[model samples]
Target: MRAYADFVVEYKLTVEFPNFQDKIYVRDGEELARWWIAQTNRPDTIFCANDEAAAGFITEIRRAKFSVLGDIAIIGFDNTEVANLLDFTTIHYPVDQQAENAFLILQNMLHSTDKTLIPLEYTLIERHTT
Candidate 1:
């Protein structure tokens, strides 16, 4: 969340925070949909915490007789299988790479006293939803 806010500030981007955040889960997204519909002024884009939540959000949004991109655009993190299945934009966070990096760092730490860590990043996957 801090990185997101810092990027927004650094880039001088205009983004609204409607306080639509919750636990990372499909059910959380489903529940948040109700609050989203209640708002008179809705944002065009919503960044979900994960693909599962985005999937849930899309499901509920469509169930209410609204188009996914037609009504709103969705961007999820962790670009899991659901992202490709749903054909929505998402941030491809490679957990495997991070895990490998961490393991290497740990192995090095065991051998030597120097224990340095590296940072991982996310890649944006452009799709129909965006």
Candidate 2:
């Protein structure tokens, strides 16, 4: 919350949920729904830590009879498959690629072969819900 407050102050944007301390304890579905209602009423954007929390937030927003991106732009971290299926914009972390690279590196080290070098790569996937 403090980080978000700092970001808001640094950007100088009209933050609707400036009272972050008051909305800090919204953990469950009902509390999340209430917070969504308050935020939607003020038309504030929401930033979530991960896809699960974003999924919960979207669920509550939908339950309250409001659209997800229509009412507020929701941003989430971790480019999970759920995010892709829901067309949610998220930061892409190459989990699979990282695992593959790690496996290859381990295999090379175990075999003690230096014939060729393996390359590591990462790319961002862009979808809807920006």
Q: Among these predicted structures, which one has the highest TM-score?
A: 1
Displacement of residue 36 (Cα, Å) in model 2 is 2.7
Task: Tell how far residue 86 is off in model 2, in angstroms.
Answer: 1.7
**What TM-score does each of the candidates earn?**
0.76, 0.55
- Model 2, C-alpha of 96: deviation from truth (Å): 6.2
Clashing pairs in 1: none
lDDT (10s digit) by residue, model 1, range 1-130: 8898899999999876556556589887887676678778887888888889888888888888878888999888888889999899999977987888888788887887565656677799999888
Cα miss at 53, model 1 (Å)? 0.5
Range of the 10 consecutive residues with the lowest summed lDDT in candidate 2: 20-29
Task: Assess each prediction's global lDDT (C-alpha) against the native.
Answer: 0.83, 0.63
| Clash totals in order | 0, 0
Report how far residue 82 has shifted in candidate 2, in Å: 1.2
Q: How accurate is candidate 2 locally (lDDT)?
A: 0.63
Task: For candidate 2, write residues 83-122 as lDDT tens digits.
Answer: 7777876666667766777777788899986534345443
| Residue 99 lDDT in candidate 1 | 89
